[model samples]
Target: MQVSDYTIGIDFGSDSVRALIVDVTTGEEIATGVSYYPRWKKQQYCDAAANRFRQHPLDYTESMTDAVRQAVAEAPDGVADRVIALAVDTTGSTPVAVDESGTPLALLDRFSENPNAMFVLWKDHTAIGEAAEINAACRAAVTDYTKYEGGIYSSEWFWAKALHVMRDDDAVAKAAYSWVEHCDWIPFLLSGGAQVKNMKRSRCAAGHKALWHPEWGGLPPEEFLTGLDPVLAGMRDRLFDETYTSDEVAGNLTGEWADRLGLPAGIPISVGAFDAHMGAVGGEIEPFHLSKVMGTSTCDMLVVPAGHEGAGAQVKGICGQVDGSVIPGMMGMEAGQSAFGDVYAWFARLVAWPLENVLAKNTSLDEATRTKLIEETRSAIIPQLSEAAEALPISDDILALDWFNGRRTPDADQSLKGAIMGLNLGSDAPRVFRALVESTCYGARRIVERFIEEGIPVEGLIGLGGVAKKSPFIMQTMADVMDRPIRIARSEQTCALGAAMFAAVSAGKYSDVSAAMEKMGGGFDAEYQPDAKRAAVYEGLYQRYLRLGEAIEKETHEDRDDAAAPKPDKRSVAEPSESELL
Candidate 1:
């Protein structure tokens, strides 16, 4: 009967953080701000001789401070005081090593140079060797340990990264009181470290990244942890105590964080979670609806209804199958391509298509000129090449696996390599670029098909993220490729909107997540049906995608046999230094 007048959601991505203010009653976003992380970067290659990927912890906190201040400052009048709750969505597997008092160790001068002190990004491949060891252990154990996760471990997870840290740097490992994730730590810091028990952990993060499940007693059994590393088993109790959904109240804001963000202390802070899944919550697709957050990468979320004729057993190859990350009282399925918009961005860089220059040159053009020029160029590109990719009109041999980044689902393997099957002088930018787009769509199709085949039903696809907002060509191309109508989010920043919804739930403005989503989530919100002709055509193309994927994977595995990393890169690294987090 009551609605909170306002809420705030902060979305923390790999390189930036966005803060948004929304009115819960109307679901209108009042103001938002994005702050880029100054020291954040994927990887910088100084030369061909070495490879290093890292991001500074300071960069994340600084950006967080800036994003929050700007959003609160820009909010409508009376909006600040009635703001009842807050939430953050962050990339998973970005682990931080913290000391006994929960302070980040990276700030200390000694560990400043240590890559381990920095957040090990979701895509970091440094732990592949450790992942292999863990995977082998899981395969050997063959217990119920990997039940929800389909019996495999990944390099892009908590255990492998933690083991990598301990095995390489004993001092840092010994000093670490907790091997924490951004999803948990960010909320923890906001609630104040002194009141530990009231702090909540996201079930989404627990199920997907930390290997926590009710069947395995919510984290791999102690014996399993010990088998991976003696140090890992030591923190078992601290890791899995409490699990909260994206909307559940984790704790109230502490005075310190409240002062920093210029909000009243005790404004509710919901437990945080992964960006993609939260994006689904933002888009507000009820159970049986799927949401694809297209960004530098693509992550898919589907809500599995309460009863789906044994659907839980039917689902496969997802990052996680958990309850209530979206629509309350139901299972939320999470999966991803690990690269989508990044492919387009990569092509953008390659073509040196200066958006600025292109626009500048056409400044005097009419509105129709601007819209038509962009859309016409895009339209000509999408259908012509993405579908034509498999036929390989010019060079039949050119093949690629979307793993230029790493794998996220279906036996989550980061050790895997991307492959290009055939190359020749005939290949042009459109050809190569189209292949990139096609491969990613193929990856998404594989996930959707797996969900259906495994018995989980996906009625339709709801689109969100920057890609969904910026490019209709890609969304429609995906629709034709997957043969499902693509639904667009009403909110420009769907994840932020989703976060605000959770903020509503945490503030007790709604009964649960579903109630919050239905009431507050926005969108054009209509489904884009697939074209009959396009769907028929894509069926054959999808078959080729599957075959090409198999062949490329086979060849890459064969090569790895001879040129694998000598030792896991994690073993070669040292401890991250200690630092005081503001």
Candidate 2:
């Protein structure tokens, strides 16, 4: 009798790490476990005001080991021995400075307490100045380094963050020999780790963030780096020129990691990629269908055949379009909002402020009772608000701009701020919450419109991640706003499933990613279709959102020459008014 084969998919998310043990034959998820980073859970080494978020290497190493061990232990006896392959997906552009031996500087005793030596998270925007400098330098160069990177170098990407951290700390700069993305470093750690020059790198992160384009023959020439900053001089050569896609095997797990994970020592480990890209694979994304990994932020993914509509199409203001980034033989396009669930999280905190600070201060109740009340109320705030907001009729007077973390698409700009307009005394918490949700939906619409305008087709939307799975109202709102059907992936852990699919291929279970996906792909959990009446009403509200955003941006950049014409009235003539709709 033949033994069954198994593979493990590990996903390193913003706040936690998850591991899924999957059967290769049927793609059934046998067991899963999640481990939150203790340090990150306590909000250590992060400065929200400075836009700096750093994760220590130990957090990743410990979490990966714990999550995998727990997940495997939950499976049937001998299943761990049957595990054939492993793959990982992580938040991208999250790069950490490492020494010559591929060890993150944060793990070194000398730099253990230094935040600059840790992994700079994708959401970190402290490198705005460095990003701007790169953009300006690229614009002036004979060959623009940003031509493939949406013509704009964002502060959220790899090079900018690395440069900023290096320039900020002389000690870190002197000790750091190279930088490694979170996705790449995790796999290397499992593969018995090698020198920085020999460790494998991911094409997804390199092409999207490091500007490693085929046209440039790899990373931009050393001249471009030297021109941008002498600090970056000769650094490109230290980084590997070759990058691997998700399907390839990075290496077999070494004895150390194998013992720690309680798995076989020689199990194959597939190359790593960003969560959104792998989530696209897990969602069974087809050509032209948009895949959205909606979490703290939203990473919108679109993959098309290289010869299809995306061939040579310069999608203006997208994150980046890279070959083999998602699938082996396709062009993967990325775009996202800098804030999505983060917007809701911020509002939830705002609503809970009185319960903790003011209401709890009135200690008529015992301390424990007050604390319990505050905790319960804090947990229920968003759900109650969503429930209330869902019942309320649409109102044009409630409007907002979803730029709390600045814009990430249709031209990357980090200097913007979020705004809530038309908030008079009548604006209740639910009303304001509804407007914020609408603003996020509107933001999604803008990205879709931009893609369509650029001749890149978005047939329909596929939703992944916590927001897509847990929040029905958010998905429904997105459907109504886009006037399109939204399909939610059936698997709760789609990114991990996607990683497992890649593991299947790397373990030689399937010929390629497509075949593995066909066998193990998670189908739609639910489909949210647009309500004609609600969509029609949202059409007008979307227009108001546009005008409101334009006005805010114009006011913010008053000195710009191409300021938008005078804003239009909030009321729309073509659409029904709030009273009429009600």
Candidate 3:
């Protein structure tokens, strides 16, 4: 009998941490455990109105400990003893300020409650101004630092968020020695790394979010950074130059972490990476097949052979194209929408306002009944809305823009806002919801079009994550809008599974990621083909969406110009104008 080796994959998401144990021989998932972040569940250290989202380091440590131990306990007896290695995937560029010892500032007593000292969530947009300045500075510089990063830097990325916090918080800025991405920091913590400088940075995180490129010798020059802002003077030096792929071993698990996870000590741990990148691999990604991780946001990944034609093309307005970021020896390209499933969630919340506000205030019903009613309604909103929206006719009478969280791809512009047009009293909830759904699909199509226009063909799409698996309505709509078929991965936790595959490779259970993927991949379970009639109708509606988007974008720029224009002196405005004087 061939003995089996097991590996664990830990995925750190925005709200929770999950641990997935897999049998390497058969790619069978043995056990899974999940733990939500307590502080984050209560909405701590976040300001939605200001677009600031922070996560405490304790939340990560506590939740990870709970999740891993739970998974170990749930597995068949002695399976935990057979576990060979572990890997991790996390959202990025979720980075936090760290001291020289590689400890997150939030872990220290004085900075424990400071939001600026915590890990800045990927969706946070507090650094819009800082991002713009970086873009401007890059454009004016001798070397364009953002060329590989789609020629645009986003507020959601590392430098912009770091600069924003440094400028905003004096205590954090003064005490911080360096910044570390959530993906990089987690592995270092598990491996018991001693110093910030010794942490092995992820190529995916560095290339995609931190503007680290080999062309300019990894990270923009110190002179360039200081020129952008004096606060960023020594940042380049404090950060790393070399980066490692997820398949490589970062280090061995320390005795402390091994005890906490209930696993053997000194087992190899693979380098960490972003969730979507690893999720693509778990979904059995192929050359030219776009892997769309459709969660709160959509991260679309495409891997092409390193020697493929146009592989060296610098596709504009994408997230980034990094060598070995997804699969080693392949050119991994990324693009995404800042809002995907979040669009539906936002609409549901908007529609549920009266129920939560008014019904909760009513004294007519008991507290228990009211609570149950609210919970049921909130849960049913999306499914109910989806069904009704599916029944509505496809038309361009109403259109919406999927920029509620700002545009993230085909040109990242966080300043843009979402809008719905042609709405009247007659337009009902279902109708509005339908338009919103179509808007997201249209946004997706735009990304596909951008890739094609840039000479990178998207042969098909592999869908993974909550929106892809749960909502057939949205998936079908996406197919119709793109006029292409969509394949949904079989695994519920593709991100975690991908991490396990990497862990297997690092532990010598497999020679490389491709071999591990071939052995462990969960094939497609469902496929959505574009309906002929709907596809044709959506073609016209999609054009309307583009027109509306153009108008909105133009208006947005004009508004910004108006805002930036120096206000006319009050005295001068009150007095006669030049024409009147003449």
Candidate 4:
């Protein structure tokens, strides 16, 4: 009997960490486990009102250990012993300030409760001012550092977040020696790396978020960084000068982590990357095919073969075009909506407020019965809303903007807010919900259109993640709006599976990512074809969406300018009655 080699893929999402054990030869997911971050679950170190989202380092370390051990326990006997390697994928640009020893500042007792010391989450928009400054500085620089990053810098990225934290908290800045992305920090920790300088940075995170490009060397020059802010002086030297792709090995798992995870001590660990990049590979992304990871936010990934037509063009208003970011030898282009499923979730929460806030406080019912009723009602909200909305005919009477969390692509602007238009007494929850869903789909269409406008072709779309698997209404709506069929990947955990593919390559089980994907991929299980009538109606509604978006964007900027403009000072001008009469 032949024994198969197994690999573990760990995915650190915004709310939880999941571990997946896969059979290397067949891509069969042997077992899986998930552990939500206790601190994050309790809403610790996060301020939703201020858009300040953070995660403690302990949340990552503890949850990952629990998730991996759970997966190992669930797997067949001897599978843990047969595990050959491990790889990690995480939410990107989620960075933390670190000390000289390569430990997060939050892990130290002195800074234990400091939110500024914790990992700045990708969704945090507190750095909007900092991001604007970086954009202005980049434009003035001798070299356009943001050229590869679609000529726009976002608040949800490395430098902007780091600079925001640094300027906001003096203690964190004074003690911090360097900053590291969550993706890079995990592999270093598992490998027992001690020195900050020794950590192997990820190309995906660096190239896409840190403004790293081959043309200008590793990172933007120190002069450029310091010019943006004196606080960033000498930061380039403290941080990494080189980056490695996900297929490369970071290091062997140290005995400490091995024992914690119930795996072999010396198994190779692949270099880390952002979750969506690996997820695209797991979804079996092909050249020119857009892989849409539809979760809280949507990450749209497209790859073009090297030397292909328009491959080298600097597409404007995208996340970035990084070589080997997705596939080893392909050029990967990324664009995304800051709010996707999040938009639906926000509406659900809004409509369920009475059930949660008022009903929970009622003294009329027993505790258990009330709890059950509330939970059931809350859970059924989306499904029932979808059903009701599906029954209604498509109309332009109601429309919404999906910028509840601000836009992430087609030019990132976190200042933009969501809008609902054409609401009246007749406009109900289901109608509003349908418009919100359509807005998110229209946001996706804008990304697709941007790529096509820039000479990059989008042949089709491959959908993956939580929304793709569960929501038929949203998926069908997306198909109608896009006028394209979307093939949904079979694997529920594509991000984790993608990490396993990189692990296979790092462990020498496969020659490259493509080989691993071809051998181990779980192909699409369902496809959503467009409805011609609905599509035609949506085309007009989509045009309306564009016009609405343009008007809103202009008004948003005008409002911002009005707020920022200096007000007339009554004290500065003499009172006309007394002075002129005298």
Candidate 5:
């Protein structure tokens, strides 16, 4: 394939969609476009939130139109008709309630206020109770179905959210039809003509999230389904069908879709796959190398040449393990941190700095102006905080866990709450900030430990995503926590690049994902090797984090009042100068 005959890779994320144009021969990105999701974050249980995190399906359409148009338009002058194949990867477990016609329920006025009308975004944790029931029931099933999920099924996946909607809103139960992922539906929208016999199932999505397995013929028994929610048990056919992997062409873009997007009809389009998995393909990292897409939350994906064994693992507390889920001949192990950069965002809000602006939060500092005074205080205070954090006699009382947004790995429970210990007048933001940072690293460590315990050797981490790209301190800390070197993938948009790789394969320009990845996917951008000294220091601190974490999980499980106070104060000052954080 010549460079002129390119492929387009569209990546649909939680908050936005990005499309990229790339040279098939050299794996070079030619031009790209990004468009944000129209609906912003939805606060839980608000007036408009009927237990739903809703978004208009139109937002996806608008972004898709703008991104694809610009991506093709911007590619070197003559690259329009040269496009061959298109592939898409999106945020996982993000399901939408669409009618038989493939439109989101939120578009209908009567369903506007109903939360079920909106997409049950991956971050929504309101289904924890329902997830617990599913896990409990899945635990009793016979087929060894839960192994694909690492052993436990998270509420964030398909089943729990569906059950929650059924129980929370009668309108959703009666009015809506198929529970479709945005990944599959977007392609369906573009294909226009006689839709595939069923867009209802995607092997990549269903196998990973919905418990639709191959050997069992489909989803687990109706008895297992009824145990979670009778409604779900009965809608088996509606909820699932034969699943297909990402490599399969779900369908072609019909004439209407082709003209709308300015592409040719019948141009091959691959089945939609999860972003994190595709991202691994993008980063050129393969099995055993954990690809951590650290965004609002962290998605950890590991591919194993062989599948796992854990029949009873789907119970709520057990993390799941799926087989033939990612690569055709390989088993894909997936898990996530319910929150990561979101934790930092929470802290940024506390400091009153707009998140994402690492620079220019402050221009200069002056004592009388207060901004200067605070900046200096913070400057002097951070090192002091670091030293104090290291040297100060931290009280046995000082403690905290990283569950502010809930857990998503190893054990998939979300009813858990966050807690803190050891706070006094002296307790301040720097200390608290450092603690929060450590809590996240320790959380990563816990998951790594779980894999190790299961005899799964994680060779190294191919870290790519917002957190890995931006933070050095956190990376170093993670190295210390994981006791392994961290290799940060070079591509800023590895997910987008991964999609491009898929595009190459779909175009027949490349043979398979592995070969395509090696030729096209750029590898590690930076590597953080384990520092024995730092790792040793982190050892002592990590033990403390564990003690605190255990206390929080235990108390939260008991639903007891959390008397443990978290540190909240920061030096009195205008926001610290941006450069100081660096």
Candidate 6:
């Protein structure tokens, strides 16, 4: 009898951490465990209204340890010892300020309870003003730092978030020596909590979000950063100059971490990356296929061979395209919407407002009864809305824009707001919900259109994450709206499996990512084919969506061209003296 080697994949999500144990030879998931962050679950250090969110380092350490230990313990006997490698994937651009000794400020005794010192989550939008400033400076420079970053800098990305937090809290700014992204920090922690200088940063995070590109050297020039803010000046030297992809090893797991998880010591740990990029590999992405990892937001990942049309092309209105970011030696292109399931969650909250605020005080129910009723109502809201909306007949008059979290693609603009144009007094929850669903699908369609317009043809789409697996109605609607077939990955944890594949490569189990993917890849579970009739109907509605969006864009802001063509050089086109921010 032959024993197979196993690898562990740890995925650090917004609310929880999940550990997956897999058989490297067969791609069989042997055991899995998940643990939600206790503090985050209680809504600590977050203000949704202000768009400020922070996560404590303890939450990450504790949840990851518990999840991994539980997963390894549940596997068959001796499987833990057979684990040869480990890898991690987490949310990107989620950077936290660190002290001189490479400890997160929030984890230090002096700043234990300070939210500003905690990890600034990717969804935080408090840095919008700072982002605009950076964009203005970049536009004025001889070389635009944002050329590869969708020609726009966003508040949700790295530099903007760090600058905002630094300016807001003097203590954090004074104490901080450098910043580190959550993805890079976790791997370093497992490798014995090394200093920032010794930490290996992720190419996926640095290239896509931090304006790190090969053409201008590693990071944006120090002079360019200084032009935006003196506070950001000289910080680049503290940060990394080079980055590594997931296919390489970050380091070996420390003895402490190995003993804590009951796994063998000194196993190779592959470099970390943003979850969606790794998930793309697990979805079996090809040259033209778009992989949509739809959850709260959606990250659409595309990869082409090194010299394909999109490889080094500076496509407008998408995320940065980085070489070797996803699969080694392939060019990785990313585009996404800032809101997907978030739109539904917003509507659900609106529906429950009356029950929570008004009904809870009703004399008809006691505290316990009221709490139970609210819980039940919350659970049933989305499903009930989905059913009622599906029952309603489709109409063009009921239309919406899925920009509740702001638009992230077809040009990155955070000032845009969501709108519903065809609401009447009779437009109840179900009718409006149906329109909202259509709106999200339309948003997705816009991204595909942008890709095609830019000469990057999307041959097909494969869906992963919670939204794809649980919501058949949404998947079918996406198919109809896009007029394309959508396939869902067989693995529920595609992101984790992708990390495992990278781990296998780092451990020398396979020659490369493609080779590992061939053996350990999880195939498609289901395919949703487009309905011709619905597709035709959606075509008309999509045009209406475009017109409404254009009108909204014109009415909402001054004349800063969103559709401007890329300038060959700064000298060729004159720079605007005024800021374009709304």
Top candidate when judged by lDDT against the true structure: 4
Candidate no. 2 TM-score: 0.94
Tens digit of lDDT per residue, candidate 1, span 1-582? 663488898898867899999888878889898999876643431111111245677877889999988987887666777778898888877787877656567867877767776677776667778878876787788674555665566777778777887787887787677777788878888888653334467888777777777775677777888877787766776555668787677778888878888888898888888887778888877667778888887778887677766446735566767766666667777778766776666555545554335753776888677776766665455445444553443233454567766677665766555555556898776678656665677788888777778777777788888878766556766787788788888788888778888888888888887778777877566566777887776677667767876776777678787586575556323654345222
Off by over 4 Å in 2: 359-368, 559-582
Per-residue CA lDDT of model 2 for 1-582, tens digit only, reads 988899999999999999999888888999998999999888788999999999998999898889998998899999999999999999988999999999999998988888898999999999988998899999999898888888999999998998999899989888888999999888888897868888888999999999898787899898888877788876888997898999998889999889999999988899899999999998999889999999999999999897775757878899999999999999999999999999999999987889978978985889898889988899999999999999989889878999999899878988678999888987899999999999999999999999999998889899999999988998999999999999999999999999999999999999999999999986987999999999999999998888988887887777443454676787778888879889
Which model, 1 or 5, shows the larger TM-score? Answer: 1
CA lDDT, every model vs. true structure: 0.73, 0.91, 0.94, 0.95, 0.72, 0.90
Q: Put down candidate 5 lDDT per residue, 256-349, tens digits, no spaces.
A: 7788777777888877888887887787776677778888888887777743442223323223455545665667677778888777666655
* Per-candidate TM-score against the hidden true structure: 0.85, 0.94, 0.98, 0.98, 0.84, 0.94
Which candidate would rank higher by TM-score, 2 or 6? 2
- Model 3 lDDT, full chain set: 0.94
Q: Is candidate 1 or candidate 2 better by lDDT?
A: 2
Ranking by lDDT: 4, 3, 2, 6, 1, 5
| Residue pairs with backbone overlap in model 3 | none
CA lDDT, candidate 6, residue 197:
88
- The lowest-lDDT stretch of 10 consecutive residues in candidate 2 is 559-568
lDDT of residue 334 for candidate 5: 75
Candidate number with greatest TM-score: 4
- Give lDDT: candidate 2, residue 93: 85
Against the true structure, candidate 1 reaches a TM-score of: 0.85
Give per-residue lDDT, candidate 4, residue 441.
97
RMSD of each: 9.2, 9.5, 2.3, 1.5, 11.1, 6.7
Q: Which residue pairs collide, candidate 2?
A: none
Model 2 scores what on Cα lDDT? 0.91
Model 4 per-residue lDDT tens digits across residues 400-519: 989999999899999999999999999999999999999999999999999999999999999999999999899999999999999999999999999999999999999999999999
